[model samples]
Target: MSGVAPGASAKGTAARTANESAPVDDAEVVRDSRPARRGPGGPMGGMGMPTEKPLDMRGTLRRLLGDMREHRLELAVSVLLGVASVVLAVVGPKILGNATNIVFAAVISREIPAGITQEQAIEGLRAQGQDRLADMLTQVTFTPGEGLDTHALAVTLGWALLVYLGAWLFGWLQARLTAIVVQHTMFRMRARVEDKLTRVPLSYVDRQSRGDVLSRVTNDVDNLSMTLNQTLSQLVTSVLTVVGVLVMMFWISPLLAVIALVTVPLTVGVTSMIAKRSQPQFIRQWRTTGELNGHIEEIYTGHALVKVFGQTDTAQRVFDERNDELYNSSFRAQFISGTIQPAMAFIANLNYVVVAVVGGLRVASGQMSLGDVQAFIQYSRQFTQPITQIASMMNMLQSGAASAERVYGLLDAEEQEPDPEPAVRLDEVAGRVEFADVDFSYDPRNPLIEGLSLVAEPGQTVAIVGPTGAGKTTLVNLIMRFYEVQAGAITLDGVDTRAMTRADLRGSVGMVLQDAWLFEGTIEQNIVYPIATSPGAPVTPEQRERMLRAAQATHVDSFVRSLPEGYETVITGEGGSLSTGERQLVTIARAFVADPPILILDEATSSVDTRTEVLVQKAMNALRVGRTSFVIAHRLSTITGADVIVVMEHGSIVEQGSHEELLAAGGAYARLYASQFAAAAIED
Candidate 1:
């Protein structure tokens, strides 16, 4: 969620233009890489961002295999089934060839029933200048008074049917097991990526393109799932089919086997050449997809301001540009990878032709039986078939590898520092927060805060005020430990914050920022937030009571009761159903429900209207009566009654005291108050 409302930056720009005094609220922002035409895409860090490349495909694949180690047993079974299926499939053609041999031998022997020997018939054919027919007859076994052996042929055909049946059964089983293994592996991969998201530092997250990160998680992982499905299911089976067919071919006839092997080098060469060209395109296709997603996300989220600025046409044109890039890259990748299968098929057909002619000559010379020649021809077809199937898998494999590389890049990203071992725990937090000798900078080359020291005693309200980019919000961020200190320590109840797990530390605090968040859910559900969303967990009576009490205190109950659904009325995350002031009120109510020991409000009322701001001030006054509260406000009037008002300039505390005392001293705080009220006076 943005820390500022839509158009807040524009408001900031206007404020700057008018008074030359707009506070730089530099926190994290969703970025667009391209130069801005009018709105979001404008001049963000300058120029088009460079796309990512897959530097080490082999290492990435190895890491992917490591993730699948848990499912190795199922994968092993799948591979064995694939092998069995291919072996049975290869043997089926050979078995059917036997029936052909039996029928031929029986037909030749029909002449025996006429009281003519096989030699006499063949010699008469040769004498009649039918040398080819006589030569073919020599390869067939002729038995006197024997016709075609129908019984033997029936048995041979039955065995062939059984062989094919086994092939189908094994293939189906392999497919099922492969699916299981792939789903399980994807499950683990997603889990790892999810965990990594939580462990990465805020700085790391801020520097990344949000759309790119999301694409890796959603699109890339989905693509990986499909790739694994194609690869795991067919790769082993195709390879084994080729090997088994080759063995059977050599067993039948070495010459024919050698002729079939000629296509191997050509197949390998074509596949390799195509793969090299397509791999980079596939990588670019996915990267461009991420950039497009990022652009859409950025534009869509800021669409409200886009319309306010009349930037719809510009936004659509930019979207078209991104979409066109994706389309071009996708087309090139598909077109290149698509050539492999047809090329392999052509090479295989060439080998098939050569084998058919040689096998026919061998049968005529009496060197090979007609049945053997038939089986060898079938073997040549099977040989190229497996090779073709494997070639067909190349596109999916490369696409999947590109997806894997991106996902693994996310998984391998640097994580946040580990919490200190033997951590110190606060048995009871009295909410005494302190910063000592703190030094920090978002960019180390340019220091923002140095030697900052402050203490918030129990139940004291400290209001931090500063000029734009003067580190007002940065102060509270440090207190929350969102950014770690470079040279000092921050303590909560006398224990270093670094010693506590982030969850534990964050659980003690409730923060309401300037830009409020309301998710897609009922008003009551959003107030309860994460507690309401946890799986299978019911909201407690106490939580419900807190929700009701807070809604009343923040004056949210008034508007809610006016609606037909009351608390049950659903609102989108965009807060379309509620006004800006109402949205801010809902987030304030959420803070009230958290009931944390410590509260940090970063310009929480900046987005509210005058009437709503009064109601919020009343609610905040009541909420902070006995809590250690740190309020960072740009408005001077809001902090007039604070127990301590700290005035800062260029990251250093210039003046700090009660409001009246600062005005009496005529220091930095006094001038700030005068300038703010003076601006108000001029407007009046």
Candidate 2:
């Protein structure tokens, strides 16, 4: 059968997209390459990114087999066992034919004419000096029965039974060994892909949706495992059985073997034709599955938006289009692959009839015996059985290869450049940060930051204010080493940030983003997560005390205490139970517990209510007392007390000074401040 089942196609597609909706062009599937696109909300935020193309099949399989090299010994053993099993099975028909010949000889030899006397048979046996047979014949004469050698017949049947049992035992051993090889190989392969994910560039990851990456790791790997488990043993056995049965057929009657060989070319031609026709359908099936998944993900996740905008019917129409495409492609693929078995069976049956007639003529002409003809016919059936099975398995093998190619594509993706050897390590960071003639851009053709220069003294708060798309968050990303600057350098305490390891640089900087994230964990665990996951020595009681102190300082402890379980209460579903302001406070407390020398607050209070914003602002002001901080906010009121406010428009800084000084200058900062003031006044 066809590997492209409707359910499997849909599931694989959904796994690939991971619930993000975006359009994928057909060209992307062929080229299998594209620059990563940063969607709204950051690199992983958008749904429906383009699907990656599968790598060439030859390379994928070669790499896959290379991975199996470590288990080569086990695979070899499995192969040997499988070959032995098939050989035993192939010999069974010949053994049975031998018994048939023995029975026929006894029947023909024991037949006596009615006019013949029993004494005559005994006298003939005696003349031939067959005393034992002569004595048995005399007894049969008195009984007037046809004497057949029952003991010899039983002996032949017993041998045949033993051969079949041996085949079964060997087959079971082969299956056991094959399972071991497949499962172990898959385990290592999975671990390797997961490790590769960590080493790949964030830029590459940002460009793709979460679902695409997950599909490679989960669905593709699963397909490989399933295919290997099902196909490996069968492949070995089928090939061996075909060869063995062919050799046996030749032994019985070379003329009949020739007839069986004629079916080979026909079977192969039919299989190849069907496979070629089914391939494109399989590809389309997977592609449309991804489209359908993307559409479902987009609509389901944004269902509220769809209803609010009265676009539910439009969404339904789009879904129907994608679903219909998947249905059509799946139907065609299945229908084409489904033809292989019946077609092969027809050719096999015709070959069988031809062999039977020729063998019968040969037997009658005394060129072949009855038992040999019987064995040859049985061998013909056995020979075509594997051919039919292999034809049926062609579709599954193709699907498996396709899945492997996709997985290899991911594993072969560009990884992050290795960290510099013997990288500089910061011993004592004092929070003195500088940007020197920095140049950067998400897109090189459209520069976002050009020749930027700035310095923040130790323990000073620098506020960055700008309109949307002013590279505010981009600057913070560069500082945190999320993205590298195209030119110049950003230094912390006289050392270029690039010179230091990313882990060290980022560990020294803490951030509170506008959208606070809280994984499923207790409140205290979230606050002390940095220490918990740190690679250094285990956290001590003193560190635990400090975490609690940070939570209290940020005023998160007060509300946490009101909950039924206080600090131990579990936060589930990304902390949906918490108010927006409460979540922000918790994130702020997490940062405070980290005790980094530098801090970044990217509109940290943008999602809070006015009353909560005032309280959060007070807590933030206190947190900024003795640390270098970058505050990127649209609200002018939040940054009024900043030591210096840098006003940015487009990609360049237009002005920089204290809030009061900027207003007095009546430049970009003044216009921004006035605009916000007017809006706030209207709201009041």
Per-residue CA lDDT of candidate 2, range 187-251, in tens? 99899898897677555655554544665677778988998888888988999999999889888
Colliding residue pairs in candidate 1: 23-468, 24-468, 24-469, 36-41, 36-42, 36-43
Q: What is the C-alpha RMSD of each candidate to the true structure, in Å?
A: 5.0, 8.2
Could you tell me how far off, in angstroms, the CA of residue 537 lies in candidate 1 after the best superposition?
6.0
Q: What residue pairs clash in candidate 2, if any at all?
A: 16-211, 16-212, 17-211, 18-211, 20-47, 20-48, 21-47, 21-48, 22-48
TM-score of each candidate?
A: 0.90, 0.83
Specify the highest-lDDT model's number: 1
Residue 290, model 1: lDDT of: 78
Largest TM-score belongs to which candidate?
1
